[model samples]
Target: MAKFTDHDDYIAAAPEQFRPLLGQLRSRLAEVLPDADELIVYDMPGFGFGKSIIAGYAAFSKQCGLYVSNAAITAHADEIVAAGLKFTKTGLTFSPRHPIPDELVTKLALASRRELGV
Candidate 1:
């Protein structure tokens, strides 16, 4: 993976097909977490709150991922499955053909911020 100095660098370096998706995710996260500091954590773009990286995102070869606290994931697992998306304990993976909804992103980001108590 290429070294990214910031979110713009990471999004610019991503595959052409995923750039728009990454941009949309970034916008949604920023909208929901206006007070959170934007930063790079674990090589991915993340929103930092109360000394913790509460949310993050990354683009891979065929998909992009939105990562939040495990509590957020568990709380929204049913909705995630209903949306026909796949997820791990802390990440939801999606592609252009099956993009994650902006509403869901907002919910997850808010939940993450709440978890951080910030």
Candidate 2:
């Protein structure tokens, strides 16, 4: 596995099966936060707002994740859980095979950006 320095590098280094899904996720975030800086934070593809990390995503063997804090996603808790996805204090987890809802991803990323007051 290659070290990733940017969002594109992170997505490119992900498992081939997950690349497309991760791309969709990254696109959604970019749509919401066009001004945010894309970088690797906590070893994942993340967006930075000023000095704070607004959001991030990662792929694993069994699942893919859209990373946002609990406070950032609280507004969508019910909908996230209703979708049969898992939302912990850290972020949301969904099956890589089952693509994450684009609208939700946009909303959460925007929420995270808002939380940063950026």
Candidate 3:
């Protein structure tokens, strides 16, 4: 595999299994941050608004990650943990076989935007 520095490259480099999910996640992100500028960052898809450091999405062999860059994500760490969130070399993610709850995602996005000063 080739080294990728941003999201587009990462998407391109990712295997077939990740393509569809990656696209779905990307669409969801856009829906959440419609006006935000989007690009590839940290070898993953990132959405930026007033600032560049914002949320992102990335997929791996096991599952995909919906990155909420705000420190606020920690506030619900306990709940997420109970719901199966965990520390990974990358970040938090749901298991490959599990579907992320829409309600949880809404909460996370709201928290993330608040952290971003949105």
Candidate 4:
């Protein structure tokens, strides 16, 4: 729906279907990087830890794009390619209709910590 540049803005603009999912993602990111400076940049929910960017969450046309801003997934591109996952250098292109990869998300969260020095 509408674009939001902060959490409260997101809460107000986000669609109902995406709310719970976004909340879960937000909580997960928070738990993973408690010391990070969480902000809503680029109209998406993003977390900034030190000079590093941990991750961000967004509801797209038909999927929720879970973004690891530091290009952490780039390092695993080959593995992702072999696994048949469609992703870019920034984030995994996943459908919200399907289940989220909690395990991989966890790994990315940890990587965010390292990248951000958190």
Candidate 5:
């Protein structure tokens, strides 16, 4: 794994095909969490509010992820499924072929901010 100094470094280090998707995710998250601090934790890019990371995103070999609080995942599980995306307890994964919707990203970020009380 590459050691990333910041979000730009992480995105630059990702595979070529995923760069644009990662960029889009980063922008959407930033738009929704303008007051949140940009963060790099566990080598992933995230947005922090208060002491907690409100949202994080990553580009893996096969997919990209949007990570938020568990409550946010639970709250939007149906939308995720409806969009034909896959998700874990705290994140959703999508490939370029099936990108995450912008509206869903906003909802998840907002939900995470509210749930985390940040």
Candidate 6:
């Protein structure tokens, strides 16, 4: 595997099946927070605004995830669950074969930005 020195590298180095999923998630996040900085943080592709993480995404062997804070998930658990995606304390997971909803992505990203007040 290639070393990931940055967000785009991390996405490009993901499994071929996961690349599109990661790209879609990245694009959605960018749409919501165009000023956020893209970074490879803690081994995942993430966005930051003034040192606060706005959003992130990663590819696992069987799933891809959109990562926000635990605070964001706690505040919006019902809405996230209603979207039929599985979210842990820190992020939401979905199969690469199934594209996650763009609206839900935008909503969650905006909520995260609000949480950070950035």
Top candidate by lDDT: 5
Q: Candidate 6 local accuracy as lDDT?
A: 0.80
After superposition, which runs of candidate 4 have C-alpha atoms over 4 Å from their true positions?
1-5, 50-52, 69-71, 77-85, 116-118
1-118 in candidate 2: lDDT tens per residue?
Answer: 5578787788777878888888888877887888888877667778876547788888998788888866777988987877778878769887764666888887788787777777
Which should have the higher TM-score, number 1 or number 3?
Answer: 1
- Could you tell me which residue pairs clash in candidate 3? 7-40
Tell me which of candidates 1 and 2 scores higher on TM-score: 1
User: RMSD to the native, candidate 1?
Assistant: 1.2
TM-score for candidate 6, please give it. 0.87
> Against the true structure, candidate 3 has what lDDT?
0.65
lDDT for each candidate structure: 0.88, 0.80, 0.65, 0.69, 0.92, 0.80
lDDT of 4 by residue, 30-88 (tens): 77778778886666778884445678877765667777745578666675555556777
Each candidate structure's TM-score, on Cα atoms with residue i matched to residue i, is 0.94, 0.89, 0.71, 0.74, 0.96, 0.87
The candidate with the higher lDDT, 1 or 6, is 1
Worst 10 residues of 6 by lDDT: 95-104
Cand. 4 TM to true fold: 0.74
lDDT of 1: 0.88
Q: Could you give candidate 1's per-residue lDDT for residues 1-118 as a string of tens digits?
A: 5677899999999999999999988988888888888898778899885358889999999899999989999999998988889999999999999998988898888887788777
Clashes of 2: 0
lDDT of 5 by residue, 1-118 (tens): 7888889999999989999999999999889999888898888899995458999999888998999999999999999999999999999999889999999999999999999998
Best by TM-score: 5
lDDT of 6 by residue, 51-111 (tens): 5788988887888888887778888888877877788998888875456789878877888
Write out the backbone clash pairs for model 5. none
Ranking by lDDT: 5, 1, 6, 2, 4, 3
User: Can you tell me which runs of candidate 6 are displaced by over 4 Å?
Assistant: none
